[model samples]
Target: MDRTTPRPGLRAQLLRTKPVDQIVSEAGHGTGGPASMRRSLGLWQLTALSIGASLGTGIFVVLGESVPLAGPAVVVSFVLAGFTALLSALSYAEMAGAVPVAGSSYSYVYATVGEFAGWLCGWCLLLEYGVSVAAVAVGWGQYVADVVHAVSGLTLPAWTVQPPGSGGVVNLPAALVVVGAVLLLVRGAQESAAVNAAMVVVKLVVLALFCAVAFTAFRAGNLTPFAPLGAAGATAAASRLFFSYIGFDAASTAGEEARDPRRDLPRAIVLSLVVITAIYCLVALAAVGARRWTWFDGVEVALVDILREVTGQTWVGVVFSAGALVSIASVVLTVLYGQTRILFSMARDGLAPALFGRLDRRGVPVLNTVVVGGAVAVLAALVPLGALADATSIGSLAAFALVNVSVVVLRRTRPDLPRTFRVPLFPLTPLLGAAMCVLLALNLGTGTWIAFGAWTLVGVAVHLGYGRHRSRLAVPAPVPAREPR
Candidate 1:
């Protein structure tokens, strides 16, 4: 064997870059041999999935934290955040249609950039998906606590409710919810289009109930101090609340599974964003108007708590809490499924351990599911919910920025490629999208930036140490056939 030949020799192919042509050629087969992912989703199901994934936790859990940052101006925060997300979502739809694959942003990067850049994108997505799932699980635990208190008139021991660092030895409720979601994912895997639609309906109904009751108590006085902290405050809250809008892109991740991706994916992304932003703005207005925005400050289960306050009845709030139970679980399952499949694609490209890429007989990535589930459960039990939300937001912003950048690059580099959906503003959309992501990222605390840096550093080391050399792209060029021999 020629020791100097590329690939097959744990030699020094650490900085190797795969040909864009080869990467693009593998478009729909990003995950390699697809065991079983049913393409049963349509426009409605896709839209619902996007809405469900982004709706939960962002408002139900993080809104309270965000309100203190912007006061009544938090309503504006939703708009800013939604705008940034919409830009990214637009780019995602374009790429999803042009590429039409399972890897989401990572696959798009691989097809445009090279192996290392794709590795970085994949790493960032891990943060977005895994941390967001853990955060949702923690939020679910809070709703579970409220439901228990409302139903039985007894609060669970405080230690059993919060994450470890948040004055609790074990966040049992959080862990339990994570375990439940994990089991659901690994066992049956993706939710059917019907189930997803049902969950979205449940979410909309509960939100409508909150808006209706809260509006009954709406007082113009609550709007008196709107934007009291000014544009800076609204932007700050927008940065924090970015967590809420992360899921609209979940629709793009389902491109390969959509019935009519080119048409449906763009529509689903736009419709879901419009529907979700309207709900968020209404909920924000009603909540702030019903009770002073200050009242929402530091609330963990803001919406449900608002219900309890307005109705003067814990049981009434419990009904909304139950709805959160449905919404958050769906979010967890959707993001978790996205995470597993992404890593599966990375593994297929030799950027991760082979174990993660292997699918069981039923076409599910059982091992990947367990690994992701276990990590998320541990974080849900140990990390504080606020920190988890921040981590997820920062990671998501980075990935969103890269996705936008990829759109611009792919356009100039591969103009011949058919793009079923196109971003309306061309360079303007992608440039603004990337700029907004970086700007919002700066708003995150020093601690969050540090955490994101650490995660990226680890990913770089992993690629250098393991992935760079092991990547399947290391293969040598094929030999040409000789004279009829």
Candidate 2:
């Protein structure tokens, strides 16, 4: 009964009734209603979900920070980050196709690695999806406030616009947006998906417009000192650019809800990665080409600034700002959805409070939504954006690393397990995925690394304190059957 000690024959205990077949069958039982809610999402809707979740303040705001590091080579940084993301996506696709569950990488790790590793994955995901949602919400507030000021010829008080450490009293707008996203998620999954799809389209059209206009002013001179800062710069910029790719996991989280998940889950995860990477590269190319890389210093809204320069019209700025507002909202909604689902999985497994596992009549984890929403709202309203971004990036890289390893483990351990999709080149693909994630992690600052270590330590403590004792997998093992006489 000791919390840290697993039951005798722990693996057999956990594996008793939850083999992949049993899990899939249980998932199918309510496929009538839950699957219907999930089936409302299609390829386009899936693509939109990816676009909405992936395209946000990361590209809009982080681009300026990365430009300074890599100069015009920021485009290359984006490409490198995209490549890393693609590698991870392939791994996710293979695993998701094989195991199609709601916990995303957490579920895959549990089934392949062991219960303890699965618990860690669920914990790390808390930072990736939950904290990152707040970061996105905070970014949305900034753009929304900007648009309001431009259109109405008035600005909210400076204190309202800035977060606490940024010399402001409170970030009212950021907190409000987080609250709004939570309410939307608590209502129903179907409603959230529809709204997300619409917003995704709007955001993509806006980015396409920006690309078109910016190309008019594209200058060959901008390409002169690509990598002006050298390999270190490219690596550093890639680290920052990595943030833009964080939401690719959103596709995997929908595993429990996808129709024909064995097929569509992999398709959605890989397809989303391909589409988002292409869009990011195009946007980075246009933004860097349209103006001097140095000009981007101190600029927060680089895309809008590019549009303004190319079109020589103030209204284009207004239009771009509006698009940013909608895009950020979509990111918040999709990420919040992912966060709630992860907690629901953890709760169902008894690794957390059981309340999180309860689904309302609408098939939504309402309590989980409220808890996650409140935590993110407070964080968004209080923390510095830089700290939030770094924390999210580190957590995501860790999760990606585990997922890549899980794909390899599952392939070796359960070769007969049916997989609808497989990563090309076997071990090579997963190896590269882990390598890229490590390279990106190396780019994180010493402080960020320290913070990541601290977070992991905290997770260890929480597991021992609560999760170890309550884990459904830790129940006493059954006695082995005696041989027939």
Best by the lDDT measure = 1
* Model 1 misplaced regions, further than 4 Å: 1-36, 187-193, 480-485
lDDT per residue (tens digit) for residues 1-485 in model 1: 22344454333353244454564455334344566555667888888878878889988888888888898989999999999988998899888877766678888877776667788999999999999998988888888888998899898887888766677777887788777766776654345446657888898898899998999889999987898788899998999999998888787777556667767877888888898888899999998898787787667778887788888987789889999899887788777777877887788788888888777666667788889889988888877888999999999999999899999988998898788789988999989999999999999999999999999999989988888766787656665545553
lDDT of 2 by residue, 268-299 (tens): 78888888888888988888888988999888
Error of 2 at 118 (Å): 1.3
Report clashes for each candidate as comma-separated counts.
Answer: 0, 0
- Model 1: ten consecutive residues of lowest lDDT: 1-10
Model 2 earns a TM-score of 0.93
Candidate 1 is scored at a TM of 0.93
